[model samples]
Each structure stands twice: as structure tokens, then as C-alpha cells.
Target: MNNRYSSNSAGVFTWFRDAAEQGNAYAQFNLALLYKRGKGVQRDDKVAFVWMREAAKQGIAFAQNHLGAMYYNGTGTPPDDSEAVYWFRKSAKQGDASAQQNLGLMYRKGRGVPQSDEMALTWFCRAAEQGVASAQSLLGEAYAQGLGTKRNFPLALAWFRKAALQGDATAQLNLGLMYRRGHGVLQSDTQAVAWYRQAAAQGLAAAQRHLGVAYAEGRGVQVDLERACSWLRRAADQGDVDAQFNMGVMLSNGYGTRKDEAQAFAWYHRAAAAGHMLAQYNLGGMYAHGRGVQRDPAQALVWYRKAADQGAPNAQFNVGVIYANGHGVPKDEARAVAWYRHAAEQGDASAQNNLGVMYANGQGVPQDDAEAVRWYRRAAEQGHPLAQYNLGGMYASGRGVERDPVLSYMWISLAAEAGDETACNNRKLIERKLTREEIGSAQALTRRWRDAHRA
Candidate 1:
């Protein structure tokens, strides 16, 4: 049987070579494929390129498409986006679906051509009409996101279904997302999980991550921590940063397994290395507290600074605390104030209260009672207990604005209600200095404030 197979292959090679030499485009293309795949000849990309070019020159669309792919992938020659685009355009103009898809991708990514969502969508539609699954998926995304056309949920869902039924993993994932978000179909976690399972089984990392989250949160499946951990580990092993971070959370909390602080730290470190902001912050906390590792304030500061630079308010506040206390560095009140300001600007009530204190005490800036009152009021309005108490004091002392026993009583009452023992005492003291009518007004103001800020 082997001898017969070898003989037939040799005969086929001979026949193709002779016809190719006689300028038969199909024969030249077939001979190139044989050389490229080493079916009947040794795989020789350079030699394959020669015959592919010959057939392509004869205006064979398939040959041109194959040659473009070779150029794009640098199979036989140096990778040349421009050359790939040229050949892909030629074949695509001849109604070649694969070439059309390739050209669309090239335009979509701005490789060898200006990025044009419209042009990409145009070619994707053409190839999709020819039943190209990948092109159909791209068309779905374009319609879903209004990339090159108006957002059309129904069209997106239709295209996604077409491609997904053809076994396109990306299409399956998108369809799952559409179902999850109720884009065109009714929101159904069960349907989302079903599609996610299909794509995850196909080794799609994103699908695996989504499936893991679904299982963890009991979105469609029961809350099965073990299953969630298993799926998340798969996605994490594939270097999905979000999955890595979630694994850290699971391990640290003993959700699916024993509380292994070391494993949590390791996972957090991995995601932090990939620039995950929360992971960096968690890593900093681990280092600072000696959780699953030796205490290293310097390392903590390093990770905290990374997360802070990424605009994490908590990390910024931690960085401010580190600078204020001289943890692994010299205490610098100015730097602390600056970091506090960063977090404060992002609506972090704690940071805003701390910044108010800094202004009040003149720790890093010139003492300005009016400025302190301004900062205190900002934080106090956000339901910050300390800021409310401080603002109340400023009113009692008549330092920032005209003294109003009513406002002072109101602010102090708010802080006291939030369980501040000192504010409780202070509220009583301030009440003694006010008339019954003034206290009544203050109480009414507090009620209005509470009603306005409920939630």
C-alpha cells in the first residue's frame, strides 16, 4: 500500500510539474501547494513562492489570495503589508471571499492602508454574504458597536448567530454577550452560559473567564466555587489578567479552596505585573502586611505607586499615608498633601477629609481657615463623618465664615448620628449655646440633608 501511495504521489508531482512548465495556472498553483506542504515534494517556501507568483500573474484569484497570505505571513519572502494588500485587493476584486476578509482585516487594523471602519465593514459584508464565518462575525461586531454603521442589535444578533452556527468561536462569545446584555434577544443568563460553555470548550480564554465569573456569581449556574475556581484557573493559566486577579480573590477568601495566602499573593503578583490596577493595590497591601510574604514597605510602596499612577483612589490614598508616615521612605508632608489631593479630586471621601485636615493644620500648605472650610464642606457634603465634625467646629469658632449656631449644630448633629463619640459630645455642648427655636431649625436642616443624600 505504501509503495502504491508513493507511486501515485510521484505520478501526480510529475504531471503537475509538466503542466506547470507549460504555463497551466491551475497546475502551477497545485505544484506550489505541494511544495509548500511537502505532500509530494520537500516543503520549500522560496520555491513555492516562485510558482505561486507565476499562477498569480496569470490572474488566478485563489493563487493571488494564497500569495497574499504568504506575503502577509512572511512564509517565502519578507513580510510586506503593502504587498499583501496589493495581492489581496486583486483577488478580492475578483469576488474571492477569503481575500475579501483579509483585505477587510488589513483595513480594520490600518496595516498597509489607512484604517477605515467603513471600508472594513464594506468588505466584511461582501465576504459575509459569501458565507465566510469570520467575516460574518466581524460584521456582527460592526453592527453591534456602530463601528461603521448604525448600531443594529437585531442585525448584530443575526450575523452573530449565522457565524456561531458555523462554529466560529468569536461569534459564539459575542452571541453570548448579546444574550447576557439583552441586546436583541431577551436577557438570559442561561443562554449566555450555554454559549460561553461552547466557546470555552473550544479553548477560548475570554469565554473561559466569562464562564468562570458566571459560575462564581451564580449568574446562570448554581454558585459552585469549585467549578468557578477550575474554570478561572484555566483562564488564568492562559494569562487572562482579570482571571488571575479573581483567582487571587478566591484563594485569599477560601471560596473554592483552603485560604492559601501564598497562592493569593502569587496570583496578585502575576496580574499586577500585567498592569492590573486593583491587583497592584492588593499586592501592595500583601507586601505591607506581610501576608504570605515578608514585610517589605519598599515593595509595598512600589506597587502602591503603580496602582496610584493608574488612578486608583484607594492606592493614591495609601500612597499618601505612606509618604505621611515615612513608611520605607522619608516623611514628606508636601508629597503626602499632593497624593491626598489626587485621591480627593476623584471623590474619595476619606482622602477629601484628610486633605481638609491638612489644610486646617497647615501641615503642607499655608494655614488658611477659609480654604480648610471649603475642603471640609466638600467632604462633609459627601457624608464624611470627620469632615462634618471639622466643619461644625469651624462654624462654632467663626473662623471661615460668619458664625451660625444653627449650621454648627446641624453639622455636629450629622457627625454624631454617624457614631462619632467626640461629635456626640460636641453636639450636646453646641446645643446648650443655642435657643430652642435655633435647635429646631438645625434639626429640620439635618432631616432635609439626610433625605437629599439617602443612599
Candidate 2:
């Protein structure tokens, strides 16, 4: 049948060429399609463009639409958005559905036209009403995102269903997300999985990634790490950054696969290069700890800085540690303080405690006992054991706040409960200095504080 079809097309090619040369618009359009697709004629985009332009000039709506696409895509000519919009508008005004959708895209993206969500919506609605699956999906997205109108989840779901049923992969993926998120319908992981499966089967990388996550988390299915790894690997192979990062996590943790630090590092490097924040942080850890690679503190700092610049508090804290210890660089206490402050301001307990030590020791900024106590208290309130011990020492020595033996005993007791050996020994020493009544008061305060702060 394929051979017969090709033969039949070849038989008609001469007739189409003759009629097109005679200025017949319909014949020119047919000949253009043949040249464009290499069906019954040698493929030549330049020849196709010539014939398509002639037909379009003759007011053939579909030919005008095709010519607009060629111009937009730079097929056989330099790309020209303005000219593409001109032809698209001409065909769209003539009720060509494809042209209407193309015009909507131009307005939506501000390509060869002023960006106008309302105009894009109007045109998308026109094409979608004609049952164009891509246009329907775009309309769904517009409604879902409140691009032109107020968010209408129900309308978005309706359009997504219409397009998905027509086998549009993007619509299938979006419909799966809608089901998963319960946007306009009851949340149903089973339904989401079904839609995701369809889209994934179509080779959609994002759908594969979503399905991989679903399998890993046991949403709508039994937990199957192997299946999750398979799907994630598929997406990662297709250059999906999230999937690459997930692959690093799974490989590093030996989830459904043999633990392979080198592979994990490779995957993390790929994702980090693409600007995945978590991947960058993990890559830093790998470099710092010599996991799957030679220890390289300089490289660790580079990756940590990348994540820190993106506002990762843990990375900021790590950057401060590196600078403070002079790991792969000159020890710069002031720079350490700057980095520590970045993380501490975001309520990182470890950073708060470290900042307190810097203040108390005059290593970075001036030695200020009050500031040290302030930072230490913040971390202590968060149940940081080291901060509790440090704060207790400050109270005992009268370096910060008023001298209060009972308060010092209470803080030391909390740290001792956390298994700090130094706190336990210091607590025993403090106990000897207090009278029986003061000791009883400190014990009661410790009990009350523990009860109030229990997690």
C-alpha cells in the first residue's frame, strides 16, 4: 500500500507542476506540499516556499497558514516573526484553525506582536473550539495559570481532558498533574498514574520523571524502587535535570540499585552544572568528604558557593565553616562572619551557635559577650546542645547577662541530658558550689524547662 501510494503521488506530480505553473492556486498548494514533504517530488524547502507563497498570495487560507509556519521556522528563508504573524493573521481571519492557533502563540510569546494574554486567549478559544488538540491544551494552560482570565480549574480540566483524549502528550501530562493535585476534581493518585503512564509511554521526559516519583513514594502503587529507578533513569538519559538529581540521590543511597558513589557524583555533577540547587550542595559535600572522588576542598567551596548564592542556608553555613577553618583558602574570619550571618539570619541553629562562638572569641567582628549570649540563646531555644553548654558557661562566668548560678546550672543540665560529657562534668562542679535549697530550685527549673520544650 505504501509503494502504491508513492507511485500514485508520483503520477500526479507532473499534473500538479503543470497546473501550478499555469497559476492554479489549488495545484500550487498541492505541489508545495509534495515538495515540502518529499512526497512524489524531490524535497526542496525553497521550492515549497515559492509555491506556497504563490498559493497564499492567491488567498488560499491553508496555504497561507503553511507559508506562515515556514517563515516562522526559517524554512527555506531567514526567519521573520513579523512576516509570519502577517500571514497567520490573514489565514486566521479566514477561519483557518491552525493559523488561529499560530497567531495565538505569537501574541502569547510577544513574537512579532505585542504580548497580550487576552488576544492569545481569544485566538486559542477559536482554534480550540474547532477541536485542535494543541490549541485545546494551550487553552487549558491559560485557564490553569490565570493568564487571561481568573483561574478556572474546572474549565482547565475540561480542556485538558478534551486534548488528552485526543492523545496530546502535554495535555496528558497536565491532566495527570490536575488529578494528582486535586485542582478541579477529587484527588486520585490512581487517575494521575493512569494519565502519567499514557504520557510517559509517549516518551515525555517530564511525565517519566513524575511517574518515577510516584512509584518511589508509593502514590497509587506499591513502593517499587526498581521501577522508580527505571523511569527516573529514562528521564535522566533524556537530560531532565530533576531526574538527574534524583538519580544521584538513589544511586548514592543504594535505593533499588547497588551503591555507587562515583555514579552518584557524576549524576550530581550533571544536575549541578544545569543549576540544580540541591545537586550543587550535594556535589559540594562529595568534594569535601572525598566521597567517590579525591578530597578537594577548593572544589567543595566552589560548589557550596553556587548553592549559597541561590539562598541555600546549609550551603551558606558550610561556606562559613570552610572560610573559618581556612580549608583550601586563607583563613578569613571576617568573611566567615559574613557567610555565617547569611545562614544565621535564616534561623539556622548551627550557624547561630557558630556565630556566637565567633563573637565571644573576637575572631570575626569585636568580642562582645552580650552579642554572644544573644546568638547562643537563640540556638539554645531551638534545643541546640552545644549552644546550651556555651550559654551555661557564659552565665556561670558572668561574661554575659547578670551572674546567676541557678540559670547556669539549668542550662548545663539540659546540655548534660543531651550526652555532652563536658556539660556533665561541669554540672557536677556547679552542683558542689550551690546550697541544697538553690540546687533544688535549679532542678525544678530544669524540669519545667524540659517539659515546656519537649519535642
Candidate 3:
């Protein structure tokens, strides 16, 4: 008996035939691999499974692992998580590191059994201690988040460093982030740059993006917009949405090359299609303002809706405006206010000021000067000049609170200092009317309040 597929001189068919008959485990596994991948043979899952089963029954750990993977990924047989788990357990019991890692993944992701972080940790710990870089990285993540152990930043850093040193690109990038953001180690931009450079050389998209940022900002590296654009373009070419968006902006503004609206639009469209919220917002603006495409309010609203669904504040506000003005749909005051409120909650200054106006004019809600004043104050505290001006008017006219010209001038002057042209003119008009001593006293109180607020 012989393996027809294992023939050195004889034809492959004769080799596989002899190998199949002779019960050669390696030959059987190799034949299965060929059949599974349709290499030197027609793809036959049933035949592949049959051959692999024979090898696995022979206690060949490699065959056992491949057979388990086939079951796990549904490549040869109906996907059977339980069967995959069973064979993986057998291989793991035999001390197969790959099987150990696979078993750990199944437990961690709850693929075959009830999820058990502790069990996952146990397997990952075993593999990691055996010098498995992936397991080390996973263990680092678990330690960082305290998945099955007490949160230990020092342990996480050690494990991440170990895995990073092993040339695991993911570990390298993640360790770089830890150093860059001071997550589990002292913030060391130099170390961050080193790790990032290693991972970037391996073409890891995330590491490339971070490296691009490092280069652009002169953190640990001299500022080089050209280098930043190069790395960003590489990641963007790989369909990294964040990288695509950043590269698109650079292209749109001619950061390192002549402005190319067409190319910028294409990149933005790709990122937006990938569910990048910010890209969707930018594309929406392009449609609305005719920057790269013909002005199409309907398309603008469509893109805006996509971003708004992902909780983008600016997109939500823009969509609301379109609805309010009947640009894309029939005028809907209620919907407009809804979007305005969403943007305001996200700390959008313009949206906050708009919300105050909405409350004041009762466009979509009942007129309530108190609500208006509340919103205006919120925006004013954030240095919204218009909000400060509105607050001053409220104080001067007693629209929301008791009338007080001194308090009004205080807000007006604050707005003026913040470069509100209208506030400056109004202050001048009020200055000509107020008595000199009264103006001096008002100015004194303003100074004290400003000093207290550090404004």
C-alpha cells in the first residue's frame, strides 16, 4: 500500500492511492489539505474530512488541529462548534500550542461553550508563558482591563512589551499606544515612536496612522507633513477609514500636493461608505455646499442622516437646518429642534445659541424666556460671543430676569473682550448715556467678576 499523492517519482494519483491504502497519517493529512484547498485535486470537503479523520484518529496532532479548524470554520463539514471544541481539546491535551490558542479563542468568544473569562485567561496564560506572542498580547489586554484578574497596569505593560519585542505587529502598535497615552507606562513619546515605527514597517494600518500623527505633530519626531501624508496614504490605500478621512482632508487642502477635489471626494466617499461618521459629515457638507459635487440638498440630507445616526453633532445640526428650511423635506420645526437639542448636548456652541433662540422664539417649543436664558448662559460660559450678547440683552430688557443695566453692561463688555463687534458698538452707545461714576462702578464690578472667573 502507498500514498498516491506523496509520490516522489511516480504520478500524484498513484502516490495518493498507495498512501490512502497504507494508512500513512502524514500522507493522509497532506492529501486532506490538498483536497480542502483544491490544490492538485478537485475541492472535496467530504474526501478531505474523511482523510483528516483518519489522520486525527492516528493521534497526529497537526491533523487533529487542522481537522478542528475545518470544523470550526465550516470549511469541510457543517459548522459544528462542539465538534471543533472536541478536537481542539484533544489537540490541546497533547500540548499543541496552536490548539491551546484556538481553544482560548473559543472560550473567550463563547463560540462553543458558555463564555468563561477565567478559563480563557488560563489558556492564554499557558500559551503566553510558552512564548506565544499572540497569547502574550491577549494576556496583556486582559490584564489591562482586569478581565479575569485584578487590573494590573505594570503586568500589562510587561506582557505588551514581551509580545511587542517578539515582532507581533498588533502588540507593537498596542504597546506604542500605551506609551504614547501613558495608559500602562510613563508617557514616553520616544518609546511610542520606536514601537510605532516597528509596527508601521510591518504595514499595520493603525500603527501607520499613529505614526503619521506623530510625524505631523513633531511628537518624538520632527514635523514632516510629507512623511505624514505618505504613511497616511499607505493606510488609506488599505481601506482604513480614519486614514482615508485624514488623507482626504490633506488632499482637499493641498497639504503636501496641489489640491485635488476629485481625489479628495473619492476618498471621502470611500470612508463614508465604510461607516465613518466624520467622513459622512464631510461628504454631506460637500453635497450641501457644492464643494466637490453638484449641490444636492437631498443627497446632503441623506449623508447627514447617515452621520446623525452615528451621533455626529455637526451632521445632526446641519440635517436639522435642512429640514427647518425645507431644503430636503417639508419644513419640520419639531425635527429641527430635536437635532438642535442633540448638537447642543454635545457642546456645539452654535447649536446651543440656536437652541436658546428656538426657546425664545417658540419656533418648535413653547416660548419660555427662562429656558432661553438657561441655554444662553450655557453657551455664554463656553465663550459663545453671540450667546453673551443675547444674555446681555436679556438682562437689559428684563426678558428673562430682573432688569439691571449694570449686569447688562458686564455681559456686553465680556462679549466685547471676546471680539463681538456688535457688543462693542452697543457698549459705546450705552457709555454715552450712563453717568461717569455709574459707569465706573459697573466697570469695577465687571473687573471683580472677570477676575473671579479667570475670564
Candidate 4:
């Protein structure tokens, strides 16, 4: 389209310049647009500003609006918010929808005048009424968020629908969100997907990502891994961070495509570089395991620490393990305990179990049998088998709580049933110390507990 305009620019410029020199406001505005776009001459904002100012002085509303934009952006002159507002107000008062929308934005952001939602809404309403799709979308946002008036879901829905029908991608995306959340319309995954598809068809990256997730999760559509991967790939190519990370996961797991660890690593690296915590954690694992890249404990530690700093419990646990084992750094029991505690406090069962062992052995903190029992119990109740067996041992030895042969038998029996060989051996030893009746009672207790925790 630009090429078409440039091709005939010389003839068009001569015609417009002749009329503009004869004081034709329309010709002046046309010439200004041509100069601004470099249609016939080298792009010159100064010349564009001169012609636009002349046309605006002759009361051409569009020229007035253009002049305001030039002032607001410092395109041809020093940026002056006050001057921009002056021209916008002049054109807006003359019933120019674009000018009204621009004025509303200036007021909304406190760019040229005092921030005033009420005034912004007033101008937005004017432009929206005049069928300006951008203004309609902004009006919908105002109503939805209670920016200038009471929150009105119905009004917001109505305005969003108006703009969306005019092919406004943002409005379509917002409308989909409203349906998905049941804000102004009935909650309908199908309707949400329909609106999302509309926006996605227009190349909206966010909409594409949402649509891909919906397909992957079988929300509003049949589960279609291939379709999900296709959509996600599109959004990832556009640099959508979430899509990039998800694409990495899909590639790594062979979902909808052949497993390609190298490609997965590339995708993860891209997202991790963009500060995605999960990507950083996953990249750390890949590096540590030598999957798709050479094993590099230093690189693994770098990524793990990055994610751990963002409060990722799994990353914290990995960092603790690394510090404790001297992987890529000197062994530091104190640092290991600190990282373990950070994750354990966040309800990570594995971290709780590890912290229990650390306490029991006096690795970093002084040995405290009772503290070990407490952490072991926390992880055991969450179905950590190792913690359950450790708790059983604690009970059998009376290390933390009162020694109870039956309780030890029951817990050890449960852990043994979960395929822990050590627990099985311990259970046999505990059984030998119990009376027949006590052994039967322990068996019944294990049954009751398992039934209660059945998935």
C-alpha cells in the first residue's frame, strides 16, 4: 500500500502543492500527510508540521488533530503537552471523533491537564457515540474498571461487543475474558474460545497463547495436542514468554511432536533469559542432567540460584542439594540448611524430609531429635514415604516422642506397603517385639489410615 502511494507521489505532490499554495485547506492537509509519509519528498516532519499548522489555522479538524499529535510527540517541534491539549480541545469541540479520543487519552493520563476520569469519560463517550472503535473499547474498559462511573458489566459488555464487531482485536480479547470469567455474560468456555479465535485470527499473540492453552487443557474444545503445539509455536515465534516456556515443555515431553531435547533446551534458554522462573528451573535441570547440552554444574547452579531467588520451592530445594553436595561450589552445610528451610516452610514435602534428616544428623544445626520428629511428621502426613519410615524409627527408639511399639509397627507397616525395603525390614523387627493382639491392632490401624487417605 505504501509502495502504491510512493509510485505516483511526484504527480500527486505537484497537484496538492499548487492547490495548497492557493490557500486550499484540504490541499494543505493532503500535502502535509504526503510530506509526513515521504510520499513524494524525503520524509520531513518540519514541512508536515508547517502545512498541518496552516490547515489547522483554517479550521480543518483533522489537520488540527494532526498538529496536536506533532506537538504531543515532538515530531516537528519541541513537545508541549499544553499546546497539544489546546489543539485537541479545539478539534474535539468541533465534533471530531479522533480528536475527542486523543483528548480523552491526554486527560486520562494527566498528560496535558489535571488527571480527571470524569472528563476523560465525557470525551470517550462522545467519540464512542460517533462510532470510533478505539473510543468504544476505552469506554468499555472505563465502565468495567469503574474508572469514571460505577462499574457496569452490562454496559462494558455492550461497548466491547460494539468494538469487537468492528474488528478491534483488543476488544475481542477483553470480550473473551469477560465470557470466560462470567463477568457480564454467562460463563461459556465455548463462547470464550470463539472470541479468542477471532482475536487470534488477527494475529494477537496473547489470544493465540490462550487459545493454545485451551486446546491443550481440553477447555472449550477437544484435547488436540497437535493444534495446541501449532498455536503455541506461533505465539512463541512472536516472543510470547509463556508460550515459549510451554513450547519447551511440549517439545521436551514429546507432546504433539517428536521429543527434541535440543530444541526444548533452546526454547527454555530463551524464556529463562527473559526472566521466567520456571524456565530457569527447568534449564537448570537440563544442564545438571546433561540433556540436550553438555553437563555443566556451574551453569546449573547459575540457573537454579536465579530461580531460587524468585522463591521457587523446587529450585530452592535443588540449590540446597547443590550446596550440601559441593556441586559447582564448596560444600556449605549452613547454606544448605537455610535453603532447605526456605522451601520446607513453603510446604515442600521433599524439602521437609531433607531438613528432618539434616536436623537428625546435626549436619548444619545441632542435632535435635524432637525437631527432626516434627519435620518428619509434616512430610509424612503429606505422603512422603521416606519421612514416614524415618518417623517410625523415631517412634521405635523414643528419640522424640514416647516409644510406642504399636505406633512404630503401624507407621513402619505403612511405609513397607509403599515398597520401602528398609521399612519392610524394620516392620518385621517391630512385629517380633509386639504381642499377637498388638500386632493385630497395628494392622487394623494401617488399614484405617490407608482408607482415609485413599485417592
Worst 10 residues of 1 by lDDT: 1-10
Off by over 4 Å in 2: 1-4, 8-10, 435-455
List the candidates ranked by lDDT, beginning with the highest: 2, 1, 4, 3
Candidate 4 lDDT by residue in tens digits, 1-455: 35665668888899899999999999999999989988887899999999999999999999999999999999988999999999999999999999999999999999989999999999999999999998999999999999989999999999999999999988998898889889888999998899999999999988998899989999889999999999999999999999999999999999988999999999999999999999999999999999989999999999999999999999999999999999999999999999999999999999999999999999989999999999999998887889989989998999989998888888888889899999998888888889999999999988998998888
In model 4, the runs with Cα more than 4 Å from the true position are: 1-8, 18-26, 53-60, 71-95, 99-124, 142-152, 444-448
TM-score of each: 0.91, 0.92, 0.92, 0.87
Expressed as tens digits, the lDDT of each residue in 382-422 for candidate 1 is: 99998999999999999888888899999999999999999
Model 1 ranges with Cα > 4 A deviation = 1-22, 38-42, 428-440
- Ranking 1 against 4 by TM-score, winner: 1
Q: Which candidate leads in lDDT?
A: 2
Candidate 3 per-residue C-alpha lDDT over 126-244 given as tens digits, one digit per residue, 9 for 90 to 100:
88988999999999988988998898888988999999999999899989888988987889998999999999999999899889888878898988889988988988998788999
Q: Give the Cα error of residue 167 in candidate 2, in Å.
A: 2.0
Error of 3 at 429 (Å): 1.9
Task: Give lDDT per model, in order.
Answer: 0.94, 0.96, 0.86, 0.93
Superior by lDDT: candidate 1 or candidate 2: 2
